[model samples]
Target: MNDLVLTGDRPTGPLHLGHYFGSLANRVRLQERFPMYVLIADYQVITDRDVPGEIRRHTTELLLDYLAVGIDPAKVTIFQHSAIPELNQLLLPFLSLVSVAELRRNPTVKDEIAHSSQSAVSGLMFTYPVHQAADILFCKGTLVPVGRDQLPHVEVTRLVARRFNERYGEVFPLPEALLGEQPLLRGLDGGKMSKSRGNAIPLSATEDETAALIRRAVTDPDRVITYDEERRPGVAGLLTLAGLCLGRSPGELAEEIGDGGAATLKRVTTEAVNEFLRPIRKRRAELGAGDVRRILAEGNARARERAVRTLEEVRVAMGF
Candidate 1:
């Protein structure tokens, strides 16, 4: 079988600029070159939260964002995580391959637990990396598109694949990380970009909303604009956003806007981001919930076919 692209987002909220620079942009580029599968990690959304929240609504919005951003359902297989039971079933055997101690060692998992406000960590959240493995291996996915922070999670997936093949038989291809070309787009406050923190700009935001959000970005109190990532990450981040949208270098953009300060920087960045999202927002407006559901239904059927076949192989490998 040929290498398949498997990558996805947790359907917790609308995607943001970080999502675009990190994975969505790459997915649009790779869809033409390879058979890509975009997963809506619906189950993973509950890994940390107490309630499922508006999963159905959030999942639909995520799908709409995918299409609006040019991830065509005709070419890319977009499937929901919970819809495929066989795929989740792989977690049982895959989980057995990993140790609780080993799970504790995953840096991403540790970071997530630390970030979560609740004192207790959910079992599903603790074993998140193994669930990630099941997400990739069940589809025989060999190329996973991810940001820098997600690399460790993929490493855990690779480990499970290697160990399972050793014992159960050669059932999975060791997947490789296709890192995003951009640097980490930190939150407006120079921390993680999350909606809960009120530091994200959703792709579906209007020009006014975009402008309003940028207005609150945390920049150092210097009245000059320069791209100093170490000392001025917040200002530098705004520059990066403008650069990505305008197709220019952040340093170059900073030089052009010398002494422009946070006001000018935010204005320029807002203009750039809104201009970049205009077409995407228009496309998003044209998408309907009906279309989203139909596309997912089709994708789920296709994904189940692939997952069922993989599980059949696993059973045979173990002489079940």
Candidate 2:
């Protein structure tokens, strides 16, 4: 069996520092070791009924971010999810293996519904986990890199794969979730780093913008810079951000900062984050629009070839 890995992000916005440490950095490394498929999940964006125009723009922006982060198109297949019809085709059978009650019980899906603005959950949103299963199984992915929150989705994927195999012979590999060691980063306001919240520092943001965002980050009123997450979540969050950028533990940095206080912590974090993002910002600026388009074209073609083979196998196995 070939070593295949599949992972992706919704093109809801530009990638951010939270994304880098969360998953993008891992993709850069994994591409070197496995035949990796990094998808631009355009269809998944519609789970919330997002604007089509915005999704198109963000998709290109995301592709640029992937390139800026050293996800070599030459090594990794980076495709737009909507471009692969086979993935959508596979979703129907996978849905049959799961019930509405099971989908409703999914913790991840429940959290998303609670967070979304819709009064009634869209059928698309409710069934997206099965859609995600199709995304993974259509590629015969053996490994999926994700954060803790996404573990439920991976579980659903495994269940769908197992059920399909038991019913129609073995046609898919049971993909395993590869969780990252780094903790998820919080937004400037101390909540989850989200684009809609206006707290995220986009990977494509200018150096000045990044520093400005850090300056506005919430911190504690305490005089001493301590890393107590419960009492000083804001200050601790900033320290966590700084630590990720500076290669030090948050507690260690908090102690090193000593009496410099919250103001000092913010200043140090701004400097470290800017210095770290300098090269990425510079490289992103240097990429022309034409370069991004060409890369996507090539990647989509390569991904389609593999997806076609997998879907063909599925059809033959199930007598489609």
Candidate 3:
């Protein structure tokens, strides 16, 4: 059988261009060739439970975002984390396999703990990677597409697989990381593209709104408008967005503009982004919120079947 491929996004906000390039586009292809699962990790969202209502809205919105971007339910499973309790059940033994030092060393968890407002980080937060490992392994996923920052999670998953097999029986495969080619697309302010940062162009944003966001995107202060990732990261970022949207190389775009001011760069970037978003906006409207739920409902049933089987095996191994 083809290797299982699994990946997903948090339900904090709408999917963005970075998501498209980083993994979703690849997922669209992988589903045709392999067993694929796209998870909307709502349970993971509780790492910061400050805004329960926002999470509720985005859980449904996340379904729309995936469908709008061409993730077909027929091609791959797309389920929310909350719907799969079996995966959560596996988290207990998996967490026992790793030490606190190992969990504390997880860079993603560390960054989250440092930035979050919570006075004390929960075990869920510290051992989040193990939960993530459960998410993948429960589906028997053998290949996980993730960003550079998430390679560490894949590593932890591999360790979990090894420990499980050594202690119990050989059941899970060691999943490999499928890293993408795109540069890490920073937000408008040049920080990570995140909803809370208020820097992302929401997939649901209108053409005018998207353009306006691009206009305010930061550019290099040194050269004013040159596209040099190393020296002019800001301008290079704009070029990256335009290049990804227009299907042109960033260098080609820079050469074509030839000393264009930041305004010119922003204008072109805005136009390219607006054009790209137009179709998605229409698709999003057509799919509607109700349709999104229907698709995810179907996906959840499919995902649950596979997850239930895996958990049964896990329970038998643990003598449950």
lDDT of 3 by residue, 187-229 (tens): 8887767667788888888887887788788875443455677
lDDT of 3 at 255: 80
lDDT of 2 by residue, 72-105 (tens): 8888888999888888888888899998899999
- For residue 66, model 3's alpha carbon misses the true position, in angstroms, by 0.8
**Can you tell me which runs of candidate 1 are displaced by over 4 Å?**
none
On TM-score, the candidate that comes out on top is: 2
Q: Give the TM-score ranking, best first.
A: 2, 1, 3
Model 1, global lDDT: 0.89
Give the per-residue lDDT of model 1 (tens digit) for 1-106.
7989998888878889888887788889999999988999998887887777899999998998899999999998999999999977899989999999999988
Q: Could you list the CA RMSD of all candidates, in the order they appear?
A: 1.8, 1.7, 2.1
Q: Stretches of candidate 3 above 4 Å error?
A: 49-53, 220-224
The whole-model lDDT of each prediction reads 0.89, 0.87, 0.83
Among all candidates shown, the one with the greatest lDDT: 1
Error of 1 at 221 (Å): 4.3
TM-score of each: 0.93, 0.94, 0.92
